[model samples]
Target: MKVNKKMKTSALAGAALLSLQALPASADQEYLLTITRPGHLQVIDMSTNEVVRTCDVPGKFGTGSIAPSPDGKIAYVLSNMTEDVYGFDIQTCDITFHAAQSQGNVRVKTHQSITVSADGKELYTVQNPVRHLPDRFEVMEPQLAVYNTADGTDAKPVRTFPVDRRITKIAATEKGEVILGGADIKAIDVNSGEVRMVTALQSWDRGPEWLPPDAFAMHSQGEQSNEYIMPYVTAKFQDDTMNMETAEWWWGISRVDLATGEAVRQEIIPFEFIVFNFISDPRDPNIFYGSFNTLSKHDITTGETLALYEMPHTYYDLNISADGKTIYVGGTSSDISIHSSDTLEKIGSIQLSGDMSTSDLRVATIRD
Candidate 1:
């Protein structure tokens, strides 16, 4: 009986120790990976804001975007210049999924169009038609290609479906619908290949004076937004006498909920201020941070601006932390400009050692 009691105590102690080991580490120990042009990637420690590791990748250009795995173990980078999709393992520093061509050896390319399914089993990329002649390009039907992420390198699209051209960015909803970002937002049914126009900036019930512009540019649009994602655009009202060349444009943000398909559009600034991407803080939904030439923090609840400031240089990409602590800015330089979420002050920077151009800043939680 004494021996049985001792065995029970030993098992309890072992279970207690195992529970301690299973506890998650503090968020302070997290890491972030920032990619730069001319083929370089820097993984930085978020706690210390210091470089932890670096890797050089070949066949990279400035026109590519990365989609990180949900577990943050891998990053799928789509490059238009190389016409290839590469899966980069952040932990092991191994590169796989080197798909350079589509069906029938046809060279395919993408421009800031990539996303991975929630389960991390499928990868999606937009394949744009190639330019056949100078000043004139061929008009092959644009398509969305879906590949099995686990297949790696030589993976081909298990299915290809028609998609409209002029799609600048890509994101997915929980229901497997693809959100196509452009002048107007569209939701494409992946299985049916049906394109539905959910939200057009002009479709909103604004007055007759409101005008939606012809183009919208967002650098870091392929991100994970639990609420929704919106791209900043410039459009304004003009007087009957005002010429199109003379009228100033106003900046605004329009977002559509993936769950309900409801959209909301509101003007942030009344003048022509450039904004690349305007993403909100989930911790505080009213507060949003974005960039164009300046890193700005604004509150949608209050008409008053929160904070707007210049950076070390111009940047196009900006992402607010999940906890709303830091704003990671990239897309134009070799540094990930880190700033305080409240004060908008320049605190620290992740500077690279060489001449590089950074694009698309994303913060992922690395899972064990």
Candidate 2:
């Protein structure tokens, strides 16, 4: 179904009013937040399956990574070709915070590494910087920049610590630590800035017969499950005589608990199809959903394919509702397709103005 563009302004004004009034104690509402190209932040009410507000973003869109506050009031967007981050009040569509990672001669980019703390007090991102010289460009070290949420529009990093390069996604844990995905999954203490390995990806000790696993974990959709999940592909020699014909390809998952920092990495099933992103069900821990050219539901514990449905097009990211009843898939196109989590059937869709590209699809729960 298509959203009415004429309701944009009026809906935003109504949302602002609702933000000021006290909501019912037991009333909880869920909304889907995402960005579209040439710059727009769209928020859709999950109950009615309609676009509520379309907030215009400040800079050029790139990856369009977003992190909503713990209370689900503000959405921090990584835009301006990943060189700048802006926080928008989803209720009023106001720019509440901004941070430009690029400086005089150096250009910085955060490749899908943006998140808010569990307490909603700080925002964190890993900045990969490069210095532009007269004749060439010099690659600089990466740093983890932290900013206070109360700093307002002209925000700056409160502190920064040197971190390993190639970090793509980050999530803050309840223990005041941030889990990072890179060559290996690592955890950094927010207060002490001490970095430690949570689990090994490329350096996994899966014996010399197995090759290093290849992982693509750019999407950040761990909020609903309260766990960071990454899907990986690897190969292993079938016998003592390592030969091309005697090898087996496999699919594995590396999951980290966002609340307790516990991590588990195991090969769930053999390599079957390409999956760009995966999210665990909040209601049922053993059930998980993945999206790409197809939508798949699997039982991670038994390596069983519970259901599979071919999608209309490829989707880069997918997220589930807090209740785990519905699934929202978007990224490649301008439409966010909704599906039934139980049956994997198409139920509805919300069409946007522009393509989402590599933008994130996030679910937010707020009081109404």
Candidate 3:
């Protein structure tokens, strides 16, 4: 597809150069940031469970992946068919930064891999570029693109390095590395571009008794827990015969600590159903929640189901409140459902103007 120069120019002229405004002032408040179809960023106040503010996102909306700055002042969204990145000031709803990944005949897609540094000075993503020839398309190598947040409106990658393909999620670590989740869990240094194995997912050494696990980590809701957690499913042979009928399927979790870059992987429970996403409890280390067609609570340490409640519909992503009292399920519909963490019961819901699609439901704490 070709670039829309007129739309890009108009969006830049209207959003750029706007002065930042003060949000409803508060010493410390938790808000949920999410995007919906047709391009809109909505902020929900955790205290009132209401859509407190709505911001217009520039460019066409497709896979609206958002990564908020450290201070929660700016939200960088990957939109425009996953080829453009725009940073919106949450308070003023102004486009603070914009970067179109594609150039000329090469079309680049980030594939939902976007993140910001801990200090909020840099942004990172893995770009898969394909060159469109007159009669054929040439596949190019994937690279990690890093952008400075201060470069407004016409931002470009300050640096880029080659990386492995199929990276779907990127999370920054406090130790100057970004944890990449895809075929395997790996950490790449932002400065040196040094890549190291954090944990083996597809290449896990589980002996000849277990089948390789299948997992996908897309949502970026680890702010409250300070960890990137993902759910997976695998089957283990129950006997020496290694018969398919005697295999026991199980659910497991792999976690990467954002502060230390430490990784942990373990099977959690028997695979009973599919879970699209999972979030750990900030208040309790042993507790976590999963969402899809149902809301289920699990004991991370014991691999036990603590509580389970069927939901009204499917939700692609789920996040926890800072206080750990309420759980919010979103990303598959117009309404984000609120539930009690202790009982897993629906308590309330926040309805948006449009469907969330594959957008992330991120919890950010804004301070005065």
**Number of the predicted model whose lDDT against the real structure is largest:** 2
In candidate 3, position 73 carries an lDDT of 83
Overall lDDT per candidate, in order of appearance: 0.69, 0.89, 0.88
Better of 1 and 3 by lDDT: 3
Candidate 2, poorest ten consecutive residues by summed lDDT: 20-29
lDDT of 1 by residue, 1-368 (tens): 35688899999999999999999875533556666666766667676778777766657564647777767777777653737778887766688676775445344667778877766788888887664655665657788988898786788778889887777667767677877776577878777888888767545555555555444644544243554466554544476563556665655666766555556766665454566677777577677787768888877766456788877577877776656788777767667778888888988777776444535666666745
Q: Against the correct fold, how does model 3 do in TM-score? A: 0.91
lDDT score of model 3?
Answer: 0.88
RMSD of each: 4.5, 9.0, 13.0
From the highest lDDT down, the ranking of the candidates is 2, 3, 1
Expressed as tens digits, the lDDT of each residue in 1-368 for candidate 2 is 86677788789878988986756556677888999989999998888989899999988887989998889999999999998999988878999999988989999999999999999999999999999999999999999999998999888898998899889988999999998889899999988899999989888786768878998787969789888987789888976576657688778888999989989998877678888888989999889888999899999889898999899899999999888999999998999989999999999999999999999998778865
TM-score of each: 0.83, 0.91, 0.91
Q: Quote model 1's TM-score.
A: 0.83
Q: Tell me the deviation in Å of residue 202 in model 3.
A: 1.0
True-vs-predicted CA distance for residue 4, candidate 2, Å:
52
Candidate 2: give the clashing pairs: none
